[model samples]
Target: MDNIDQIVDARGLACPMPIVKLSQAMTGMEVGQTVEVTATDHSFVPDIEAWCRKTGHQLIEVNEAEEEIKAYVKKTK
Candidate 1:
Protein backbone atom coordinates (compact mmCIF):
# COMPACT_ATOMS: atom_id res chain seq x y z
CA MET A 1 0.00 0.00 0.00
CA ASP A 2 0.91 3.67 -0.01
CA ASN A 3 2.57 5.66 2.75
CA ILE A 4 3.98 2.74 4.69
CA ASP A 5 5.89 4.06 7.69
CA GLN A 6 8.14 1.10 8.36
CA ILE A 7 9.11 -2.19 6.79
CA VAL A 8 10.33 -5.32 8.55
CA ASP A 9 12.22 -7.79 6.43
CA ALA A 10 11.72 -11.04 8.26
CA ARG A 11 12.61 -13.18 5.28
CA GLY A 12 14.51 -16.40 6.02
CA LEU A 13 13.33 -16.33 9.63
CA ALA A 14 11.10 -19.00 11.08
CA CYS A 15 7.78 -18.86 12.94
CA PRO A 16 8.43 -16.96 16.15
CA MET A 17 11.31 -14.92 14.84
CA PRO A 18 9.26 -13.26 12.16
CA ILE A 19 6.56 -12.33 14.62
CA VAL A 20 9.13 -11.27 17.19
CA LYS A 21 10.86 -8.97 14.76
CA LEU A 22 7.53 -7.60 13.60
CA SER A 23 6.52 -6.85 17.16
CA GLN A 24 9.82 -5.15 17.90
CA ALA A 25 9.55 -3.03 14.81
CA MET A 26 5.95 -2.08 15.63
CA THR A 27 6.90 -1.04 19.15
CA GLY A 28 8.41 2.21 17.94
CA MET A 29 5.57 3.09 15.61
CA GLU A 30 2.79 5.51 16.43
CA VAL A 31 -0.91 4.86 16.21
CA GLY A 32 -2.26 4.79 12.64
CA GLN A 33 1.22 4.22 11.27
CA THR A 34 1.63 1.32 8.89
CA VAL A 35 4.26 -1.40 8.97
CA GLU A 36 4.91 -3.76 6.14
CA VAL A 37 6.44 -7.14 6.93
CA THR A 38 8.01 -9.52 4.45
CA ALA A 39 8.53 -13.06 5.70
CA THR A 40 9.32 -16.47 4.29
CA ASP A 41 7.61 -18.55 6.98
CA HIS A 42 4.48 -20.30 5.79
CA SER A 43 2.93 -19.78 9.19
CA PHE A 44 3.21 -16.02 9.04
CA VAL A 45 -0.33 -15.54 7.77
CA PRO A 46 -2.10 -17.16 10.67
CA ASP A 47 0.47 -16.04 13.22
CA ILE A 48 0.24 -12.43 12.17
CA GLU A 49 -3.56 -12.59 12.04
CA ALA A 50 -3.69 -13.88 15.60
CA TRP A 51 -1.15 -11.29 16.71
CA CYS A 52 -3.11 -8.46 15.13
CA ARG A 53 -6.31 -9.69 16.74
CA LYS A 54 -4.72 -9.99 20.16
CA THR A 55 -2.82 -6.73 20.01
CA GLY A 56 -5.55 -4.53 18.52
CA HIS A 57 -3.54 -3.81 15.42
CA GLN A 58 -5.36 -3.77 12.10
CA LEU A 59 -4.18 -6.26 9.51
CA ILE A 60 -4.65 -4.30 6.33
CA GLU A 61 -3.54 -6.78 3.75
CA VAL A 62 -1.53 -9.92 3.08
CA ASN A 63 0.15 -10.77 -0.20
CA GLU A 64 1.92 -13.98 -1.12
CA ALA A 65 4.53 -13.93 -3.83
CA GLU A 66 6.71 -16.76 -5.10
CA GLU A 67 9.29 -16.49 -2.34
CA GLU A 68 7.75 -14.28 0.31
CA ILE A 69 4.59 -13.38 2.18
CA LYS A 70 4.07 -9.69 2.70
CA ALA A 71 1.74 -8.35 5.37
CA TYR A 72 0.63 -4.79 5.95
CA VAL A 73 -0.38 -3.95 9.50
CA LYS A 74 -1.57 -0.68 10.94
CA LYS A 75 -0.81 0.20 14.54
CA THR A 76 -4.00 1.06 16.42
CA LYS A 77 -2.93 0.81 19.99
Candidate 2:
Protein backbone atom coordinates (compact mmCIF):
# COMPACT_ATOMS: atom_id res chain seq x y z
CA MET A 1 0.00 0.00 0.00
CA ASP A 2 1.49 3.35 -0.98
CA ASN A 3 -0.32 5.85 1.18
CA ILE A 4 -0.59 3.84 4.34
CA ASP A 5 -0.63 6.32 7.19
CA GLN A 6 0.45 3.89 9.86
CA ILE A 7 1.69 0.34 10.15
CA VAL A 8 0.75 -1.92 13.05
CA ASP A 9 2.91 -5.01 13.34
CA ALA A 10 0.93 -7.38 15.51
CA ARG A 11 2.85 -10.41 14.35
CA GLY A 12 3.41 -11.95 17.77
CA LEU A 13 0.31 -10.58 19.46
CA ALA A 14 -2.65 -12.82 20.01
CA CYS A 15 -6.41 -12.47 19.73
CA PRO A 16 -7.91 -9.16 20.89
CA MET A 17 -4.54 -7.50 21.30
CA PRO A 18 -3.92 -7.28 17.58
CA ILE A 19 -7.40 -5.94 17.03
CA VAL A 20 -6.86 -3.65 19.99
CA LYS A 21 -3.74 -2.22 18.43
CA LEU A 22 -5.47 -1.82 15.08
CA SER A 23 -8.30 0.09 16.75
CA GLN A 24 -5.86 2.37 18.51
CA ALA A 25 -4.13 3.14 15.24
CA MET A 26 -7.39 3.92 13.56
CA THR A 27 -8.35 6.44 16.19
CA GLY A 28 -5.27 8.51 15.45
CA MET A 29 -5.88 8.50 11.71
CA GLU A 30 -7.92 10.83 9.56
CA VAL A 31 -10.71 9.75 7.28
CA GLY A 32 -9.36 8.24 4.03
CA GLN A 33 -6.13 7.32 5.78
CA THR A 34 -5.04 3.73 5.92
CA VAL A 35 -3.35 1.39 8.36
CA GLU A 36 -1.47 -1.82 7.58
CA VAL A 37 -1.75 -4.55 10.17
CA THR A 38 0.09 -7.84 10.26
CA ALA A 39 -0.77 -10.55 12.72
CA THR A 40 0.25 -14.15 13.34
CA ASP A 41 -3.02 -15.38 14.70
CA HIS A 42 -4.80 -17.22 11.92
CA SER A 43 -8.17 -16.50 13.44
CA PHE A 44 -7.51 -12.80 13.05
CA VAL A 45 -8.62 -12.97 9.42
CA PRO A 46 -12.27 -13.41 10.24
CA ASP A 47 -12.01 -11.22 13.30
CA ILE A 48 -10.70 -8.33 11.30
CA GLU A 49 -13.35 -8.81 8.65
CA ALA A 50 -16.05 -8.77 11.27
CA TRP A 51 -14.52 -5.68 12.82
CA CYS A 52 -14.59 -3.84 9.51
CA ARG A 53 -18.24 -4.73 9.05
CA LYS A 54 -19.13 -3.56 12.53
CA THR A 55 -17.11 -0.34 12.38
CA GLY A 56 -18.12 0.66 8.86
CA HIS A 57 -14.47 1.04 7.94
CA GLN A 58 -13.24 -0.12 4.57
CA LEU A 59 -11.13 -3.21 4.42
CA ILE A 60 -8.95 -2.79 1.40
CA GLU A 61 -7.10 -6.07 1.34
CA VAL A 62 -6.30 -9.08 3.44
CA ASN A 63 -3.70 -11.69 2.48
CA GLU A 64 -2.50 -14.72 4.34
CA ALA A 65 0.83 -16.21 3.37
CA GLU A 66 4.05 -17.55 4.82
CA GLU A 67 2.26 -18.10 8.13
CA GLU A 68 1.42 -14.42 8.44
CA ILE A 69 -1.61 -12.38 7.62
CA LYS A 70 -1.53 -8.84 6.33
CA ALA A 71 -4.51 -6.56 6.29
CA TYR A 72 -4.98 -3.09 4.91
CA VAL A 73 -7.80 -1.01 6.32
CA LYS A 74 -8.92 2.48 5.53
CA LYS A 75 -10.84 4.72 7.89
CA THR A 76 -13.95 5.90 6.09
CA LYS A 77 -15.72 7.44 9.05
Candidate 3:
Protein backbone atom coordinates (compact mmCIF):
# COMPACT_ATOMS: atom_id res chain seq x y z
CA MET A 1 0.00 0.00 0.00
CA ASP A 2 1.04 3.56 -0.67
CA ASN A 3 1.73 6.02 2.13
CA ILE A 4 -1.58 7.30 3.44
CA ASP A 5 -1.79 10.92 4.50
CA GLN A 6 -5.05 10.38 6.29
CA ILE A 7 -7.39 7.63 7.31
CA VAL A 8 -11.16 7.99 7.29
CA ASP A 9 -12.89 5.38 9.40
CA ALA A 10 -16.38 5.17 8.01
CA ARG A 11 -16.81 1.55 8.90
CA GLY A 12 -20.12 2.08 10.66
CA LEU A 13 -21.35 4.81 8.39
CA ALA A 14 -23.78 4.24 5.56
CA CYS A 15 -24.03 5.23 1.86
CA PRO A 16 -23.28 8.90 1.56
CA MET A 17 -21.65 9.25 4.95
CA PRO A 18 -18.47 7.62 3.83
CA ILE A 19 -18.32 9.83 0.78
CA VAL A 20 -19.23 12.83 2.86
CA LYS A 21 -16.44 12.24 5.31
CA LEU A 22 -14.04 11.57 2.48
CA SER A 23 -14.91 14.86 0.83
CA GLN A 24 -14.59 16.69 4.12
CA ALA A 25 -11.18 15.21 4.73
CA MET A 26 -10.00 15.91 1.23
CA THR A 27 -10.92 19.55 1.60
CA GLY A 28 -7.96 19.99 3.96
CA MET A 29 -5.56 17.81 1.99
CA GLU A 30 -3.20 18.90 -0.70
CA VAL A 31 -3.28 17.52 -4.19
CA GLY A 32 -1.51 14.16 -4.43
CA GLN A 33 -2.23 13.41 -0.77
CA THR A 34 -3.78 9.99 -0.23
CA VAL A 35 -6.56 8.93 2.14
CA GLU A 36 -7.60 5.48 3.18
CA VAL A 37 -11.29 4.95 3.86
CA THR A 38 -12.48 1.87 5.64
CA ALA A 39 -16.22 1.34 5.40
CA THR A 40 -18.60 -1.44 6.26
CA ASP A 41 -21.23 -0.38 3.76
CA HIS A 42 -21.09 -2.55 0.69
CA SER A 43 -22.41 0.27 -1.46
CA PHE A 44 -19.26 2.31 -0.76
CA VAL A 45 -17.36 0.55 -3.53
CA PRO A 46 -19.43 2.12 -6.27
CA ASP A 47 -20.17 5.26 -4.29
CA ILE A 48 -16.50 6.03 -3.70
CA GLU A 49 -15.66 5.20 -7.30
CA ALA A 50 -18.37 7.53 -8.56
CA TRP A 51 -17.25 10.30 -6.22
CA CYS A 52 -13.67 9.97 -7.44
CA ARG A 53 -14.80 10.06 -11.05
CA LYS A 54 -16.91 13.13 -10.48
CA THR A 55 -14.31 14.96 -8.43
CA GLY A 56 -11.28 14.03 -10.57
CA HIS A 57 -9.61 12.23 -7.68
CA GLN A 58 -7.59 9.07 -8.13
CA LEU A 59 -8.85 5.81 -6.71
CA ILE A 60 -5.59 4.06 -6.06
CA GLU A 61 -6.69 0.76 -4.57
CA VAL A 62 -9.73 -1.08 -3.28
CA ASN A 63 -9.79 -4.07 -0.98
CA GLU A 64 -12.80 -6.04 0.17
CA ALA A 65 -12.52 -8.10 3.28
CA GLU A 66 -15.11 -10.26 4.99
CA GLU A 67 -16.34 -7.37 7.11
CA GLU A 68 -14.83 -4.23 5.70
CA ILE A 69 -14.28 -2.41 2.43
CA LYS A 70 -11.15 -0.32 2.05
CA ALA A 71 -10.42 2.28 -0.61
CA TYR A 72 -7.32 4.36 -1.07
CA VAL A 73 -8.03 7.64 -2.85
CA LYS A 74 -5.63 10.30 -3.91
CA LYS A 75 -6.65 13.87 -4.46
CA THR A 76 -5.96 14.99 -8.01
CA LYS A 77 -7.66 18.33 -7.92
Top lDDT model: 2
Candidate 3, poorest ten consecutive residues by summed lDDT: 11-20
What is the overall TM-score of model 3 with all chains considered together?
0.95
Query: What is the C-alpha lDDT profile of model 2 across 31-70, one tens digit per residue?
Result: 9999999999998999999999999999999999978999
Off by over 4 Å in 1: none
- lDDT tens readout by residue for model 3, 1-77: 86899999998987789999999999999998999999999999888888888999999999989899999999998
Q: What local distance difference test score does each model get?
A: 0.93, 0.94, 0.92
Candidate 3 segments exceeding 4 Å error? none
User: Model 1, 7-72: lDDT tens per residue?
Assistant: 999999987999999899989999999999999998998899999999989999999888899999
Q: Model 2 TM-score?
A: 0.96
